[model samples]
Target: MGHSLKKSGLRQTRYGSGSFSSTYKFALLISLSRLAIEKGQDSCEGLALEYTDIAEKFIELYWKQAVPYTFNDEGQLILNQNNDKQAEIVNQIIKLRKIYSSLELLRRDSEEWLTLLKEVECTVKKMPVRYLQNINGQNFEFLYPLDQCGKQLILLPQVMYCLRQFSEIIEELCQKRWIDYIRKNSTNAPILNQLPNLEQFMFEPSRNQLNAVASVLVELQECKCFYCNKKMRKGSYAVDHFIPWSLYPSDTGHNFVLADSSCNSKKSNLLASDEFLQKWQERNEEQDLVIVDRISVLGFLTDKERSHKVAEWAYTHAKENNYQVWQG
Candidate 1:
């Protein structure tokens, strides 16, 4: 039998709950859902997630938002994450951003990186993790128990399955709510009136990082587009996500493919055909070592197994929903 899940409870906590003081709740939900996909299985068993691991996810989620958002060439301002003040995690990331240009650089400094993780873990355990399941004045306790989780937060039985099963919905809902919280914050009101693609700004990988990835992919693909196999001249190709970022937002090294500008644009936000999917899987299997050795240093997660698992999920989802497949 399939695992039983209370979709209503999840909805109530995320949507019907009272106003939020900070965006932590949304981040926590997104983190849990993504972790469920990455670490847990589609089973009815409970899953124990380390506090430090959760903290790492928190950093990745908040890192981009900590930077100043530029609007209309006037000036740049960091969006406030809390009603009263900037979120603590965001402030910490902002401080680190001054010292490091990319997450990969900061990660190389073991001392500073570990310190940030420790701090973030403490904040996460104290704040959102403590109060996420609380609806109104009562504790729902549907996701996890507050007191039972010591070193790690344990997802309740069937929670992991439900999270994985509904990952896309959970991700979209959290992102939308997170954006709404930022928009509603009084501090952000003035600057966000004409906000341009807040979702992309908040979630998408940095353009600089993609450019760096493009350079590596050029060598990997031998200046040939993965889709058309056509020779790509300098400055004529782009790094394309094998599984669309819109489908699965997280960047995994194995999911990237070098494609000419035409194929990249044509394949925008659509799953490539089955022929391409098979080719992508084969490429990852053959070049797993090279991808990990080279691309992981570029700051992308480079697990071939994990990337393939995500692709399996994405393609399965597309098939179920009859999503249009790009015929490249």
Candidate 2:
């Protein structure tokens, strides 16, 4: 019975207040967009009561962006609570967690979050929404997306925009928390890196890096996956970090490799096992000749040593921290 959102329904400039960025608001929009698309058939009926638990999705988003790993000498990455023990980092995480745990992402019976949720919700709900009410004490039924809402033309642009916004925020916060944590503790460190945010590249890659990973990496590797040495094609390949970008923020020619999509996704942001690392090293050495031209064209990094130091730093961290390198 709620009134439909109007073109000017948005009130808050963004989600979260004050110091917090619009990350949560944007992420929820992306999540909501996904939920709607997934349940389009029923939702388009304008009465399916398409339900979702926004809180859960927000938590998952938090972990995917914030999770950091410490490695043991065997060259593997593992979770280390101690790494997040610093009072400042711990406080940041605590604050961030409170933001997640107390998210007004979904409308609740409590009047406080409901208004915030409504204001945020209108940013994406252009079409008529029948209603929104809690069902099982936790889950919320977003109920009904008019025909216009289901159209890809309307939906796709919003989805991509939300996703790009989501990725930028994730990239910023991930670097702020985890990378900063590593830097403070590792003054004498060899090579610590930030995990490659695969989403960022796929969706909104840096203006400074190889904008064409499939073609460039294919040429570099002779159309072979850098990890498995398997043949690849434009659509079949995944661009991966030779040194996980979760460990290193830099994305340049020397650090990139083409891999089977399955292999790259499996690796996620984990450090590669010794075998793969050695292979990566060899590939890096071989690509040094053409690196300048390729990277310079993109105007990213021309220094091959930056990539080398990153690799060295990553391996040394794995060696020192006893992190378990990802094997699969």
Candidate 3:
């Protein structure tokens, strides 16, 4: 997915497609197999790395099978997998991985192969975290934030894809008693919190990211309330997430919008009072033109009032519009 790190211009790096490296694609397959034996399911990436042998094998297979390709059809665009040279490399890697996996379980490994595999595995493990950390630590805050340890990076689309994939994997694993797998790597259990759960299996935009998106919505919606088309006047219009934070804390960004306080609050969490919903339905889903007094919309409401209602409206609106909603 988008999160897969790729080298960009001027030695700049970008998130990967979440695809395994050619030499290491089989590593994922082997890792899954090992995990199934231990926990009866595929293990999370972090959890899988706890076993050096499994991790090594996986990386080896990925590099071996990950041969890039080319298309002789001479298409307008030559995809990476279609590039002739790369494809050959990838095919070779794939073949090697298969051969290695098919070996008898009790067979002894060749000394050269074992040594090379260990080196490859360690290098793969160390390189990514280091690269991501370096990028994040760099003062250059271009469009994306990179982790100092190179272990974390974000790509809007890649992050989305990973979330979907992770969700799918977690759901599949749920069919088995995967909880018992935790015992195999107790030292890493604390990190589980960092892993996404089924309910929150997506990245939540940060305050800055949310704000950036909100600003875009303001401009795109022409500084008017999206629901009512009411012209926004003075001060910043509130941006709210379409999905209420209360119900879905994980979903955020570009999906938010600008709205007058009354319409905004009524649309809180994309829901409102029964009476409001009735009126909304009556208006053919148009936001009610009759809004709360301008005084209230202009921050005249009490802190408590805003905290309970207006704040929710603001936060949700910000999120829906993809503005960075500051938590503080």
Candidate 4:
């Protein structure tokens, strides 16, 4: 309902709910939709994803709730999740995820969560032919609750809303759970690992960009790092993708810049922390004739407008949720 990129019309889940909203039910489905798309290639048939490939993918979204902070005279914070505290936070997040996956939701008196998913499958089977696609392959097997990995999924017209809802549901659920766990008056002291970090999720690691391209950006920036205005040596600077490669994997020319190796490393895959949002946007907006010529020869600015749109879409979500962007 909030936002969607669905191709077909929305199909309401037959079973109603108070425990989970209709939007959330679709959110769950949407998360699955994303998983299927991420693992498979586009084809006339549809897209598919591995069943086991889910956990790692889910973890990326699972940690979206833990926001981090650094204290100075007032408090402390770091550019990335390099500290022991962050590690503990990640460990506990994984632990909770294991517990969560094990939960059967409505089947307290019966089987696992997959039982309910079976029922979900039954409901879906009755839907029209388009939504009732097949999922059978040697590489794919039913994951239960979810589906067989690499199973083709036919997304509805409101698909984007469904995927967007998955993130929203996750952030809300994680915060509420963590808050309840932390605020409860249990006899046991809160295990630091059990206590979720306040930092939201950061994107996963990506392959490094080409050095030839990195050097070109260095010259373009007058040797000043994009994140920090500091000078960077020719062979020392790292080329960073402004809108993380995880979020937007295509290697766009305008999306890259030379930065202090530390800054590039520290920024990791998180969006540029809010402070640098202006500079990042301004750099993207630079389209002078001379700059355009240089960018054309050294790198590719295939579609500046589209690139900016993708960045703004990512930043919009972060800004709305009060998630901190990375600043190294």
lDDT of each: 0.85, 0.45, 0.35, 0.44
- lDDT for 296 (candidate 4): 44
How would you order the candidates by lDDT, starting with the best?
1, 2, 4, 3
What digit string (tens of lDDT, one per residue) describes model 1 on residues 13-43? 4564236788888888888888887787767
User: Alpha carbon lDDT of residue 80, candidate 4?
Assistant: 27
lDDT tens string, model 3, 213-302?
455556656787766677887454666654355432322122355566767666665444334333323432232222222111221111
lDDT of 2 at 239: 77
Judging by TM-score against the true structure, name the best candidate: 1
Question: lDDT per residue, candidate 2, 108-158, as tens digits?
Answer: 224644443343234324311321221222323322223444322233223
Top candidate, metric lDDT: 1
The C-alpha RMSD in Å for every predicted model, in order, reads: 2.7, 19.6, 22.0, 15.4
Candidate 3 or 2, higher lDDT? 2
Task: List candidate 4 stretches off by more than 4 Å.
Answer: 1-133, 136-157, 164-209, 288-301, 320-322
Error of 1 at 55 (Å): 1.0
Q: Number of clashes in model 2? A: 25
Instruction: State candidate 3's TM-score.
Output: 0.25
Clashing residue pairs in candidate 1 (N, C-alpha, C atoms within 3 angstroms):
none
Single out the weakest 10-residue window by summed lDDT for candidate 3: 293-302
lDDT (Cα, 0-100) at 290 in candidate 3: 21
TM-score of each: 0.89, 0.39, 0.25, 0.41
Residue range 1-328, candidate 4, lDDT tens digits? 3222222112123212212211223323434544433333222233333423333333333243333333333532222221113333244444444545222122232453344334333333333122322222121111221243224333333333344434434334433443333223232123333444432223222223256566567667889988778987767788777877655444445677778888988888788876676776676676444345554443243346546665666686678677667756
